[model samples]
Target: MSEVTTPAMRARPKRYLYIAVLIGLLSFLAYGATYPSMQAEAAPGTQASLEVDVDLTEWELNPSQFDFQQGDTVLFNITNSGRFSHNLEVSNTAQHLNSPTIGAGETTTLEVTLDNSGTYTIICAIPGHSDLGMTGELTVSGDNPAPAEGEFLGIPAMRLSPRNNTAVVGSSQEVRVTLHDFTLNADSIEGANVGGEGHWALFLDDELIASLGEPSYTLEGLSAGPHVIRAELRNNDGSAVEPALSSEATIQVPAAAP
Candidate 1:
């Protein structure tokens, strides 16, 4: 018996063809989605590179100068070509970067981002290393300008003893900040004369921690890291002086022995 050709029968085969095509497109899309990621994994992009070879015999660093663009990702490759061990420290008032101590025939890498454009000082953190001439310079060019000196009220001036970016962590640090053109009087701080200082406010990492009449203080309980100590001159009324005469120092703290 011969079957009759119906319009519905013809439509059924066309529906199956559409469904098959749809699935093929879905599979192609899934495969295409992973292509870029696979390509990226195969070949990564390169930024800027800096290579430094250190020798303790001469107490000198090769390629004493490095330059880069601000906001660029830079890879610092350091190799201790000398027999003695050495570490690297790059720091400024706002940030600090360091390399672990690498022994002779050892190489290390430090990835850094120069967030701002300025001159950065590099030195060996090992005791007496920097004095022996293990130092270098880094210059980053960018649109941002270097920080200007903070304005002061009257003749206010503050100088931190031992300076900033010089302290070691896990050790007792004695900080003496001398303030000129103002007298420190904590008792009568409230409503004190403008030029005559009351008590000084101490800030660590921008957090107010102490208000003391003396120009000296002891730093403790600091974890292993870099810290910024700031001192501000206040009026007798305990209010911050106008234009804010302040001084800040960055201190590096090392990890304590376990």
Candidate 2:
């Protein structure tokens, strides 16, 4: 009688082990409730006290123009204070070169969050000076994010290679900015719209530099003559709603080498 166990072979292996443990517990509780973690003593850079005085041999643009309003999480305490060598970048689209680098009295901070309204830019990709302008612009959202004829979210047109467009102010310039066509409805990329995509800014001439997620760069201790760089394609609440393809370039820094 010790051989009487048959309910269809124990309910078919307990119904295939309860459907493989309920599909691995709903894929580990949906990846632990959607990605979240950032605390290694927090503050990676971005606290804002306002002090952007980047002068790559007098290109001139102190307080050029920056407004920030949608939802502002502000903080751009970059300090290259001048003496050559510089970096800074922030982006939403124009293909990904999201900027960030500071050297020459070095100090960094750029925890931006803007929330979107429309109008975005920030330059310095290095190559021939962002096409000869070194760029700037960021406005975000608000261009009728919908309520009548829907469809809003665009800033994907990044395609640069040939050594990240070009830049040779002092030396070492291999910069890269690659990302493209990031269509969106908005949820993060500038909040509201509940989908995605937006952010761009890289300037080293006027010195904002890069926030690049991937565009490529190596720029090192600059100090030569004549410089300019640019990149702007934003919309993640920092704005620059595409200035008819906003961009700039102009390079000539090669000097320091005695």
Q: Evaluate all candidate structures by whole-model CA lDDT and list the values in order.
A: 0.71, 0.51
Q: What are the per-model C-alpha RMSD values against the true structure?
A: 10.9, 20.2
TM-scores of the candidates in the order shown: 0.42, 0.28
Off-target runs (Cα >4 Å) in candidate 1 are 1-57, 148-258
Model 2 misplacement above 4 A: 1-70, 80-84, 91-103, 106-111, 116-177, 182-224, 227-243, 256-258
Please estimate how well model 2 matches the true structure, expressed as its whole-model Cα lDDT. 0.51
Q: Among these predicted structures, which one has the highest lDDT?
A: 1
Candidate 2 vs. true structure, TM-score? 0.28
lDDT of 2 at 176: 52
Which has the greatest TM-score? 1
Which residue window of length 10 is worst by lDDT in model 2? 143-152
lDDT of 2 by residue, 80-179 (tens): 5555444545554322343344345766565666545555556554434444455666554343221111223343355443222233634655545454
